[model samples]
Target: MKTKDALYNYCLRLADSNMIHGQRLAEWCSRGPFLEEDIALSNMSLDMIGQAEMLYEYASTQSEAEHSADDLAFRRSEREYFNCLLVEQENGDFAQTMMKVFLYSAFAKQLYESLLNSNNETLSGFAAKAIKEVKYHLRHSSEWLIRFGNGTDESKRRVQQAVTNLWRFTQDMFEMNDADAALVDNGISFTTEALSAKWQLNVNEIFTAANINIPETNNTITGGYNGIHTEHLGVMLCEMQYLQRAYPDAKW
Candidate 1:
């Protein structure tokens, strides 16, 4: 891929990851396990949506036609989204949600750190702004993970199961392709391979602090970066795309 194509793909991947995860988190709106958690989840959802808007807006500029950020977010098919499989997984329970958030925030924190030095000025600026928000996100999720992991027997058991179930999907977050390679070579994007080590170290420390044991399972699932997704993504995209598809050109 050319430099521009690589940059466009990189931006879209970032946008899709945030958009999908934000949509998932928004499902918790008014449905959180508690009042305070409800507010926190909604705030995180808003933050992720804001990040998606910034990323997709940049992606739109790289496209031939004038595509709006909403268009890029809600009008795309599941096969076209470049988010990792982990973000699109269904929110099973409070424990499961926390697990997902913990994993994603850890990765995002590292990703934004590297992106701060991107050769692409817009990407670098966006990363500089987003890293601050991601820092809070990481702290919040890590605290929740620690609480649940060491809270009560039931809480610990449920969160442990959630971590086990979600672990397979974690591999896809660091899965790099030719686009990533191109961007990394040109300094337009950071290599996720380099970030993965730090991400794992951070996660491991959090797990230890939480009194949770890392699963010894070696079954790693992949394929979302190439547009292949689990069954859940279709349902997510259907609900998310309904308004835009039902009434084309509709705007709030």
Candidate 2:
């Protein structure tokens, strides 16, 4: 692939994850455990969507055809998206949601931090702005995980179950293809493989503090980058794309 196409795919990978994950978080609105927490989730959802919009806009510019951010985000079929499988999984429960956030935020923080040194000024600038938000995301989710781990025996069991269930999907976060290779070679991005060790270390630290045990599993799941998603993503896009699909040129 050309370098421009590679960069465009990279942006879509980031943006698609944010858009889908944000959609999941939006499900928490008016449904949080409490009012304050509800508002917090909504705000975080907005943050994720905002970041996705920025990325989609940048990606749009790299395309040969004229397409806006909305077009890229809403007009694509489920198979065209390149987000990690971890972000597309259902938010099972409050504990499950927190666990998912902690895992993804840990990976995202590392990914964005690496972008600080990117040869592309646009990516580096986005990283500079996004790192602050990602830190808060990590911290918030970490605190919730700790609370769940240290609370009632029931809470501990639920969270432990979440860890086991979600652990398999973690490997998907590091999956890469030619787009990643091209970006790495051009100094516009680093290899996802390089982030694995540090991601594990950081995760171990948080798990230790939370009194949670990391699952011992050799099994790995992949293919989200190649757009071979679990069944959930197609169901999600139906709702997310409904308006745009129904009214291709409709405007407020």
Candidate 3:
């Protein structure tokens, strides 16, 4: 029973991460720097939304409540969300947005790689399916990272500032809690410590080539796993849930 509860929480965390990320990316729909870049970000948003739906669908089957995907998504309160701080962060500038994307895609790619071998078939399958899209996400973000970092003086300055500002949130990506412990012990999930190391290596490789400065501070922000988030999340949720909250069960 404890394991079951842990699994449910784990699933919710994964679902929340993807859903919030997609929600944030959707904000870039028409706001991208260029028409082509705009469409690319939109496509990435759809991929994340689809991945969230798949995870939520599986999560819906796990508990007695039998919650639907939409319920787990639109109906959940801010305190119920388990997304990491990085994705829920406000989209600051185009450089900031791309920095967050690169950071998250690196983490997600490593995480999904670990999940591929999980004993839980639902999780493994979801990882397998989402990983391909994550690869594209990484490629796109990394490309931007290079261009922005190695471009003009202003572009380099902005991307560097974005990295420094967002660095604190990176630690949240490797956090582990009771649910994570249970999942690890049960062979349903692995320790994020290992994934974090690989992620750092990948980041270093790219940053070296792109001339992007890695932040020096080791300080980190946390608590999103515990349903505590930045003020930005509340505003984002209000926008995201307004329709569903105002018109419950009004699906076409």
Task: Predict model 2's lDDT versus the native.
Answer: 0.92
RMSD of 3: 1.0
CA-lDDT, candidates in order: 0.90, 0.92, 0.92
In model 2, the runs with Cα more than 4 Å from the true position are none
* Candidate 3 residue spans exceeding 4 A from truth: none
| Rank order (by TM-score, best first) | 2, 3, 1
| Best of the candidates, lDDT | 2
Clashes of 3: 0
lDDT of 2 by residue, 1-252 (tens): 799999999999999999999999999999999999999899889999999999999999999989899999999998999999998999998999999999998999999999999999999999999889888999999999989989999999999999998999999999889998899999999987779888999899989988998888898888998888988999999998999999987899
Residue 99 displacement in candidate 3 (angstroms): 0.6
Cα lDDT for residue 158, model 3? Answer: 93
Q: Candidate 3, 218: how far from true, in Å?
A: 3.8
Each model's TM-score, in the order given? 0.97, 0.98, 0.98
Candidates arranged by lDDT, highest first: 2, 3, 1
RMSD to the hidden true structure, all candidates: 1.0, 0.9, 1.0
lDDT of 1 by residue, 179-215 (tens): 9889888888877777999999999999999988878
TM accuracy, model 2 = 0.98
